[model samples]
Target: MRRESRVERSTSDMAGGNRFYFPTKAPESPAFYTGRAAFMDTVDTLERAISHARRILSARQLLPVPDFARETFPATKPQWKGMGNMFNVVGTRMRPKNYKKITSLLNQLAECYNVAHVGDAPSVARATKNVLDMFGRVDAPIEDLEGQKKPVTIDDAGRAYARGRRKEASARVWVIPTKTTDNPSVVMDPEFFHEKILKSYRKITELPTTSVLINNVPLAQYFVNPADRERVLRPLKLTGLLGAFNVFALSRGGGTTGQSGAVAHGLAQALAAHVPEADLILRRALLIRRDPRVVERKKAGRAKARKKYTWVKR
Candidate 1:
């Protein structure tokens, strides 16, 4: 929450006088604007983000229906705080000020969720949690102060899936840092994050980063050596390695590569579940959307598209 007055360089480094810090975590995409809107209308409705996650996962059962129906969406103190800040940043970019749009988007997401999961309760549960985790505190389309609309068309499910894919790819990529024993700069090969204290959600997606964040370690670190992290934290996270059956892998999809990448993304995502600090590890992996199309060669092909036999210019 700390804001640096000027995230800038020295005068010599300033060309047109522009500098900024990229927030470690960005907001969810606007594809789910409806849910974002509804979530914003109220503070305690903060739970709406959670509820919306369920709704998108399973509208009929996963989602909790309020005891009473309301004529209009509810608004609360936090909602006002967020909305006010929203406009301050982009100024009129999040226009139309219509929360209904957000609700509609949520509905669409729910519909898509129903279709995708169909009957897997566990996956439905996972998706619900994933949705909430990704957007619960993230601001809405504040950038849309101008009240723009990204209509949900027939292809929106596909598009939304792609957006999700991009986030998984480029978001918080983690690289493992091997300890002195393993080679400090080297990505640790023996370390494992998901070997125990886990279930279906536990999947070894990629090699973890060397550096890690332990929520309970900060206060104690001021008095102890930083190297203590290995003796303390690593032992706790990698306890699963004691067992025999385990394998590590990398995967991505939905942006163009398809469902394989999606699984890798999901596997990393599962590791991050319930453990925010673990996210920093996966963040080191730079996964993201690749170019949609291949580049064309400059040379003229005498035969097929790019292949040409050894031919004479006669």
Candidate 2:
């Protein structure tokens, strides 16, 4: 007696006139359904179970399924086509609780169906790792953690105010626009004066003169050194807004150098606040930076910071 081939048995199992004989139901056990139909049926069952779980969880208000998951894993006919795409059904808004529940259900289904035999679907271990990695991430909130305050202030009189510090010295400065009628000085043109009377009564508008007062004293009297005077006025000259506004500063502590530097810094910030357009220029020129340098302290074995004792071999 000779054994029959698989083709001969399949042909004989078909109906007399029909070309196909579809199974009414899936195999009882996972091992029996190891073909394409088995894989498609398993995928379809998992999809249905997920949908049902989502509805139940949503109705109970336990876990609300995200919109992304619904859009990605829409209900479709059970077919072997695109079975591998089922692994892409991760939810975007599922929190930790929902993630745990869904993953647990997935693991249970994988075990029941022996999903390990289906090579097309992602492995249960890999999917679990990916899901855990994706949902574990959290975005940080954006905020000003340092609580820094602005350097400039405005007064009721429309004046720009600022404070500056340098080496134990600090200055409070205010910049205000100058009024044309404040000073009625005339410019004497040589040509007109020479042709007419030596002293004619011709009133002409003169360039505005910037007046800077420190502690109720004139800037010239306060800072005797020409270099100190220039340092304090450098911010105005650099911005080409000299004589555009009046500066009233109150500086104390430290010597002339520190006081001048502090006043310069304050004036720069006040100018930036008043003009608004010259902020970038003043910032680039480094006039707004507070000097961080300080006098070095004396060491135990040295007279000064690095000045050591006289070398003695004895």
Candidate 3:
């Protein structure tokens, strides 16, 4: 045959060698992707990872079983609620835009895993490391939910005690079911009663009337502002156990607002202790967590915190 050009010879040889012929190129580096493309790719990868994690956690019994069977009262037949609110207690209901959904999912899984494997230190540690690795991937700071909080306990005297803080204020609170024999006559600040609150107490026939005593003073006298009184009573009001329990609080540090908030926090915890079911409600209301905010310290040049000294033209 007449001398074929080098390219023509190679092409014919490649074509004749196989039914299909294609050029192979090196894989594109991640850095070559545009910002949007990179972001989209990362999101997709993370979404897949989240699904994988859910499956792994479910297999490990660290997530709630989706199809739990509940027995009907009269029929006593096991009924599947059909995926039945798997995230009723934990996990986010938000759409997966960025990291929020995945963050909550991983965090809750980690918590459940930690709680479930408390005795198995080696496995718990490994699981924690894996969870932290996932959190790092998402640039999230994982909460230390490993330790199971001690279950709220009741004293032999039927009282639940809890401590709470807000700003610089701290409070020690005790809650007890109102009883027929528990007398309020010995209170040091008996003159500081609120008539409206007392009226509400009287209206509660199903449960004994509730009373609030702060430092041996009636709540009304302890908090002169009606708003402060309301803040202190909010937890009880939300639980609809306003007149069902007695609250005794000893508050120290900070101002009236802080003290009221502290007492409210303590009251919420105490209520949660007394009524375990109310814990979820209080948690939803964010009453169980301590307030981390405080009065910002005054800087050297500032008049008060961020308030700058009056600027004047030279």
Better of 2 and 3 by lDDT: 3
Q: Note the residue pairs that clash in candidate 3.
A: none
Query: Any idea how many clashes model 1 has?
Result: 39
lDDT of each: 0.35, 0.63, 0.64
Which has the greatest lDDT? 3
Q: What is the TM-score of each candidate against the true structure?
A: 0.21, 0.46, 0.46
RMSD of each: 26.9, 26.4, 17.1
TM-score leaderboard ranking: 2, 3, 1
Better of 1 and 2 by lDDT: 2
lDDT of 2 by residue, 1-314 (tens): 87756765676567553445445796765645544444344445556655554454445443433555445432221111121233344412334454455545555433322222122233443443333333221111223222234658768886888998889899999888777423111111224324433465445445455799988899999999999999999988877666677899999999999999999999999988877677888899898889889889888988789998899899
| Candidate 1 structure quality by residue, lDDT tens digits, 110-146 | 4334333444565654554355333232123444333
lDDT of 3 at 50: 49
Please give the range of 10 consecutive residues that has the lowest summed lDDT in model 1: 154-163
- Is 1 or 3 the stronger prediction by lDDT? 3
Q: Is candidate 1 or candidate 2 better by TM-score?
A: 2
* Model 2 TM-score on a 0 to 1 scale: 0.46
List where candidate 2 sits over 4 angstroms from the true fold. 1-146, 181-205, 312-314
Candidate 3, after superposition: displacement of residue 245 in Å?
A: 0.1
